[model samples]
Target: MGDELTEETGHEARAPAEGEADRRPGRRALLVGGAAAALGTVLLAREELSHLWWRLPGVDHAREDGAVDYRGAQWIAASSANLRRADRPDDYRIDRVVVHVTQGSYRSAVNVFQDSSHRAAAHYVVRRDGHVAQMIRELDVAFHAGNRQYNERSVGIEHEGFVEKASSFTDAMYASSARLTAAICARYGMPVDRTHVIGHAEVPGADHTDPGRHWDWDRYMKLVRRARTALA
Candidate 1:
C-alpha cells in the first residue's frame, strides 16, 4: 500500500506495480538487510562494540550489582572504580585462579576494596573462620593480579591474614577456600591442579608474594581435589 523506506539508504523502496509480481522485499528480506546494516556498524565500531554487547538484552544480561558467584558467599560491592568491567569467558577466557593473602583481616580487605584509590581487589575474600565475601563479580575483571594478562584471564581469591603466619592458614579456612576454588574451576572447566590454581606470587611479573610459603600447597591441593570430586 505505502512505499517502504530502507534505513541504510533512506530511499523509498518502490512498491511493485499492480499485478506486476509485487517485488517489494518481504519480511525475510527486510531482516537480512537489517542484519547486514548491523554487521557493517559493528565493523566500523569494533572496539567500542566489544564492551557494549553484554548490555544488550538477551545477550549476556547484566547481573545484579551484588550478586555472588558462590552460593554461600556474602555479597559486598567493591568500588566500581577498583575493577574493570568485562564480559568474561567471552572477551577474556578465564582459565586460572590466582590465590592471594590479605596480610590483614577480612574486614580490612573489604574496606580496601571499597576504597577507589586502592586500585586493586580480588573477586572474593575468605576469612580465617571460613566466611567468604564476594566483592567483585566473576563476570568482571578484578585488579588483584599485578600483571594485566593474568588479571584478565584469572579469578582472584584473597585469604585473610598475613603470609608469614602459618596459623592463619587454619583448617576451616582451607576447607572453605578449597570448596570455593573447586566451584570456580568447575564453572570454567579448568583443571584442579597447581597449574590452574596458583598463588599470586606465581603470576608472571607479580610484585607481591601472597598465599605465600606457609600456605601449604600440598595439603590445599589435596583438599581442592577432594572437594572437586565431591562436586562431581
Candidate 2:
C-alpha cells in the first residue's frame, strides 16, 4: 500500500523487522530507492516530506515569542498547536497572499485562534477600524488554508466580519489590509496582482466561500497597488 502523508494524517511507511518479509519499503528505502520506478515515485511525492521538516527538533532557529512582523500591529500569539514553526522563505518560498474573512468579529476570531482545538489560524487579522493583530509569525506556517501546499506557500490574512455583509468591509479595513498585503508583497518580491493576492474561495479544494461575493476585488487591488507604490 502507498504511504499516505497529509496535514492531518502524518503516517509514514514502517520498515519490516530485520528478518521479516520485504512486503513494503520503509521510509529510508523510499528515500534512496534503487529502481527507476521507485525514484520516480519519490520525485513525484517529495513535497510531502517538506511539510514534516519543521517538526524536527532544532531544524530552525528559535524566535522570540510575540514578535510582530507588521510594525504597528498588536502581537497576540496563536496557540502553539495551531501553527507550525519553520524557517520560511528558506525552506518554503512564500509567493501568495490568501485573503480570508472571519465569519465573526475581530475578538471572536482572535479567541478562536488562541484555542488549540480550532486547529486553524492566520498569520494576521485585520479589524474593521484598520486595526491589525499579528497572531502567528510570518516565519511559521499557519493552518489557515485547507490545502496543505497553499498553507505552506502563502500568508493568510483574516479580515473581521462576515462574507455576506458588504458593509463589514469598511474603508479603514481595506486601506490597512492593503498596506499589510503590500508589505508582504514587497518583502517577498511578489507582484501585487490577482493571482498572487487571492481570496479563500480561490484556493483549490477549498469548500469555504470567504471574502465572498461582497468582497470588492477592483477596489481592493487598486488600494493594494497604490500602497505598494508608496512603499516603493
Candidate 3:
C-alpha cells in the first residue's frame, strides 16, 4: 500500500542521486555566473551605445561638428568640418604645440572655423585682446597643421590678426597664448623648448609662414617659461 502511495506521489519526493547532491550548488553557481556575465555584457553595451549617441546632434557633448572646447575656453565649436573626433592619448600622443596666425580678425577667423567647406580649424584661438576661445578639444585632432604626422601629435593655437602686423601680436595676446602653451606642455609632459614648441611655418611639409616674422619667439618663450614655473 505504501509503495502504491509512493508511486502515486511521483518523483517529486524521490531522493536525489548520490552525486547529484554535490552538483546542486555547482548548477546554481553556473546559473548565477551566467546571469552576472549577461548583466555585465548588457552594461557594456549600454556604455558603448551612450557614447555613440553622444556623437549625434542634440546630445549634451561636443557639437555635431566639434568637441567641447579644450579646458573650458569659450566653446566655439568648429563643427564637423574642422576637427576629427578621436580617443586621444589612446590613439595618439600630444607631444608638440604648433602656433598659427589667422591673418584676419577674430570674427573672420571664427567664421572660417564654423564654415564646413573651409576644412580648417585650430584647437584654440587667442584674440588680439587676449580673450581665448577653444574650438576643439585636446583629446581630438584639429586640422591646422599642414603635416599629417604633426597634426596628429600637436595642439594648434591660432592668434587673431596677420603675422605681418607686429601690433597684432600684442603683449596681452602673447601673455595669454604663452600661458596656454605652457599649460599644454606641462600637462603633456612636453619640454617647453623651441623644438617641441614651433610655429606653423616650421612644420616639415612646408609652404606656410604663419605667426611669421613678428611672432617674437624670444619673449614668447620667456613668458611660457614663467607660466610653466607658476604652474608648478
Best by TM-score: 2
Stretches of candidate 2 above 4 Å error? 1-37, 40-59
Q: What's the distance in Å from true for residue 176, model 1?
A: 0.2
**Model 3: per-residue lDDT, tens digit, 43-105?**
989865654554555643343443443454687878677888765555678899999999999
Positional deviation of 177 in candidate 3, in angstroms? 0.4
Each model's Cα RMSD: 13.0, 11.1, 14.7
Q: Give residue 180's lDDT in candidate 2 (0 to 100).
A: 97
Worst 10-residue lDDT window, candidate 2: 4-13
lDDT of 1 by residue, 1-232 (tens): 6778978898997756788897667999999999999998988799657756776777774678667899999999999988988888887889999999999999999999999999999999999999999999998999999998898899999999999989999999999999999999999999999999999999989888888889999999999999999999
> CA shift at 136, candidate 3, in angstroms?
0.6
Error of 1 at 34 (Å): 37
RMSD of 2: 11.1
Report the lDDT of model 1 for residue 130. 97
Scored by CA lDDT, what does every candidate get? Answer: 0.91, 0.91, 0.84
